[model samples]
Target: MYRSAIFLKISLFFILLILPGTVACYAQSYKIDSLSLLLKSHPKQDDKRAELLLLLATEGMKFDPKQGLPHADEVLSFQNAIKNKNYVASAHRTKAGIFLYLSRFPESLESYNRAITVDKILKNEVGIGAALGNIGIVYMTQGKFPEALKYFLQALKKQEELKNELYVGIMLTNAGIVYTEMGDYKEAMSHYQRALSVFKKYKHFVGQANTLGNIGIVHSKMNNLDEAIKYSKLAIQIGDSIGNTRISARENGNLSGYYSKQRQPDQALKYGSIAIQKNEKINNIKSLGFNYQNFSDAYYQKKNYALSKSYALNALKIGQEVNVTDLKRDASLGLSEVYTALNMPDSAFRYYKMYKEYGDSISNDQKKNEITRMGMQYEFDKTEAVYREKQILAEGQLKQQQLQLALNRAELQRGLQQTALQKALLENEKLVSEEKQKQLIISQNNEKLQSNKLNLLSQQQRFDQLEIRQLWLYGILAIVSLLTVLIYLLNLSRIRKLKFASTLQLREAEQNNLKLEHQYQLSESELRAIRSQMNPHFIFNVLNSIESYIMDNDKRTASRLVQKFASLSRLILENSIKSLIPADKEWKALRLYTELEAMRYNNSFTYSFEHAPEISLSTILLPPMLIQPLIENAILHGIIGQAITDAHISVTMVQSEQTLIIKVSDNGIGLNRTSNKTLVNVVKEKSIGLKSIRERIKLLNLQYPGSASFSVDEGPEQRGTIAVISLPVLGVGSGEI
Candidate 1:
């Protein structure tokens, strides 16, 4: 019977050991399944159902956060309806998972604290440990390695007591990732190796692949190119065999990065392309973004600027689509580098500034989360103390009743002390759990804050890119406009010069035509005046001769004189109408005039005509009837009335300097003082032909300006007049007749 009693005690001990675990497992399953069903239901009940939903929601969150969020909301609504602290805490925990997945890290952190509060109130050490582990993971994601490690270690102790190896391994792996990011490759490798061993012992292929890929990434950061490539390739192969394309893509991208760092552009490009293809096939937008970024780097290394820019832009697009803040930040950096290489310093600087701002924002967010987490831990500890006190009071009441009936009070008392110690230990563990949960919450919040900062940076980069494009467009337009204006101005200047040249030519031609017309008019007027003067003189002389013949009654002499006068008159009239007459013709006219004068004087005067040897009579030309009047003046005025010893008048012509020099001189009683007046009057009244010659000279001077000159002067060595004339030396046979 004593053996049976001992067996019963052993059975009770075994039962107690298995009971908590089984109860915890059953409760967790019930909660998860109930939450899933409640979420699946089209409609929910009221506040009481909401409390049940909160319990289920927290349990469901471990496996399926997407399914847990609505239940969490229901629980929150129930807490609002009933003001239940426990329900509020459960809702907060469930919501934390949802928010964490949504990247709402600040809200998730707050929710995690609320959950920790509920766990403290219930004095649930395991729950607090689990929550702390999750918080540690969040911190790891945020790169808060120190804070995350502290919580993780605490969680590790709780998980060891619970013998939860899988969760412990996951936490270990996360710790490794944080260390790797911190550049503590050795410590990171150790953590990863420990996690890898645990995963392998459990036959967790996915976990193993993840750990291996992370190890490769750490090696890559350390610049162990060969080891990085080897491990990455192995991870990719394992992931591929297991149909885990997400892991495969990640590993491929890492390998590509390794190749890129080694400056093997071809190999980098090959792996990067494969990674992109796999990511695309799997519809993994986040992985695709990373792969595109890697490809951009590879192409950039090859100096393919256009392709590099395109891929970088594409990576940015995918990162935005996936809402992957880290990817977006990376893509923006790549794009900035591309622009910098392309000589777009402004764009590069803008993106770099955006990167810095986002980084600062991330740091600020981490600080806020850390503060909140510490505050929540403080609150959880207070609540846990209250729960511990309540448990002690209940144990004390049970012990008092048992003490009254005990035969072995000492043993009973020892057992009571042991139980009290155990209770005290549980309380200590609870405090540790609360501390760990706070640390994890802080870490998770920091991670979310970092993600938000990265997103802001990406948005700023996009804006900068748009601004850059606008600047380029404006610059191009301005340059084109400036060039166009320059061309127009040049064309306008050329046109103005051309017009000015045309106007100058026209003016020159018009001036020449005006000069020619004036010369021709003057020549015609001279000819008319000469004809008018000579016609009247010839008529009066003929009439005078006829009358003298009648008075003398010598009919035959009168008749001969009249006929000669008529013939001379006809010759003079005909020659006056001609434009030019030969020099010989002008001499003949002078001889005729002398003959007529001799007839008038009746042999009182004689005349001689002389020509210089240099004068070519055949080629020479003179104005018509110009010499006749000059001879008439000498004969009529000088020789007619004077008693001259030699009544002879000589006409001589010579050529000098393209001019005609003619002298008609007579030796008679030289002009008396009263006779000079009479000679001047006669020149004015009867020397119309001389006046015509003067007008012709004026016309010639106007026509050929400085080219011709005519003047009359007193004879140098004779009592006669000399006429000097200059004309352009026209070639032989070129003179007008």
Candidate 2:
């Protein structure tokens, strides 16, 4: 038994060196080698071998599920043979992972519970955390996202404390994917971005690609196609660079969908084909199914009804084989669309009905399962409460017994005192009798009285000693009670300080969040202003042209220009009141102003608004009346009274690095070399609009610090003022500054 204990401690020491999520093939081989040595030394080392086998099985599950299952079975058999309860618990956990891969969810759940029980008995925190995380994965696979999230969060707290960054990133990405499925894009993006940062920092290329792919999916859902494309391309690039076929295939599918949504059918088809080919090469059933669905959608957009139908059917078959309900739903939707396009009403209706039924059934099943789980949880909590109550009752009984024992001791002490008092009285009487006898003789009478006085003095001394002992006992008890009170007060003061510190930390975090939100809002407002300014430049230029005609004494042309300028000014003023105007309306205002400005300069200067299809003017919001000042500055500084017939201005809005980059550049003289301050400070001091923008940016910085920025510089490869404002990409529901 002593040798066995020593061997077990040694094995555990080696296990501690193997980090979670890093037990690769080589690590498993090392563990196996160690197990063989242990078996040779201790011929009856079945239990130790079983413990090592469980770890080996877990490692194998990552690469070879079939091989892992046999290892798990072997571990379980050894545990049963040796009747080792500790190994039995761990064997169940290993078996659970194998069962999960086999899609035997009920058995997996049971095995996980068994592992949890054993871990609890062993006080194994890491094992408990792992079991919970695996259970969460099971829930996720069954489409129970909320339940999965609960367990995942619990596991995450433990893993974070353990500083298991690799597993932490994986869990974060999983949680984010669940949120994406639930349509909580903002939260999903936050998690995915955090995971991406971790993966990049750790140089985990595959993890980075996966996170980027998920981020792309979120942006796609939010209708930010350009951002979706950007992230998807990044994922593809990283995956390709790392030679990770799985990530490459997945990203290809994402890009296909992004291109299809952007109405780029040719690019969509190209990527969809690449995804399918890569998935085929890797034999990834999940990726293959998504690839087929993407191809079907791309084909449908291209009006290839026959090809669309074929791909959709293929996707449906793959989805059903894999039991991927979401994929099946998408396939059905795609088939319905293809049939409708082919003008087959009856066939289209059939697929549509099937799609609706499947969707409803999935939803109903989820709701029922959630209700059942909640009921189970409530019962478990009730049982726990009852057990706690019993524990408390037992403790109370023990305390009562202690108190009774103390009381009995005090009573016994009093009884002893009474007995001593009786003995003292008897002795005193005896002494008095003896004294009386001695005093009988007439000549010895005085000597007998002196002896009686001496006996009384000895009795008084004994009584005083007893009194002192009683007073000492009372003083000790009083001091103990005072000391206990003092200790409690000291503890209370420490608790108060802790509470204050916690409150202060919470307040600081809230203040920081508020600051970030304000900064985001300010950046958003500036973007709107830049967009709004695009229109007024053309309007003012047209008015200037009409002034030129009036000075030239062309009354008819001047009158006609005045009428057009008046109408344009009214439209601009009306549109300026809105946070966002239609792209066409903004274009019209820009055209009118551009024309007027051209007439004023005899068509020597030119300007244009370059629109990207990615910019959805209707849904996008900008700050009202923000752009005119910059354009005015450009005209006043760049073109006015200048001999530069080649002068031109351009305004562009594009999203890059999760920031909306708005640039206003011109072919004009650069900043005055004589200025003592930077352009930003000069704007802050002299320009009301710029100052307002700065104040707004400051407020936004409070909310989204370091997320948005603005700067004024010469355009790259061009000699002109470039006023650039970079705002974080905010969603539709995001409010104005």
Look at candidate 2 and tell me the lDDT of residue 209. Answer: 76
Clash totals for all candidate models: 1, 21
Candidate 2 runs further than 4 Å off: 1-64, 81-111, 157-170, 197-207, 236-246, 265-286, 321-323, 361-737
Give the per-residue lDDT of model 2 (tens digit) for 598-658.
Answer: 6666767778777567876555544444455666566556555556768898878786756
lDDT of 1 by residue, 1-737 (tens): 00000000000000001114322444535656555565467244554465556556545544444656786686666464644355565566667766665445567667777677777877766567767776765555444545676777787788788787876787678767655655567988998999899989998777888888788777766667798778777877787887765566667777777777787878878877887786666454555666777788888888897898898888778656645456566667777788899999998887667656545755665565556556656877999999999999999999988877685787789899999999999999999989999998999899899999999999999999999999999999999999999999999999999999999999999998997888577667656656553657656766787789889998987887777776766766676666666666666666766776677667787778888886777677676665665676666656666566678888887666866667677665444422455655765565554556677667766655676665655554545455545555444455555
RMSD of 1: 47.1
Q: Which 10-residue window of candidate 1 scores lowest in summed lDDT?
A: 1-10
Local lDDT at 92 for model 1: 67
User: How many residue pairs in model 1 have overlapping backbones?
Assistant: 1
| Model 1 CA deviation exceeding 4 Å by range | 1-68, 71-94, 161-163, 233-249, 262-289, 302-304, 310-333, 348-737
* C-alpha lDDT of all candidate models, in order: 0.67, 0.69
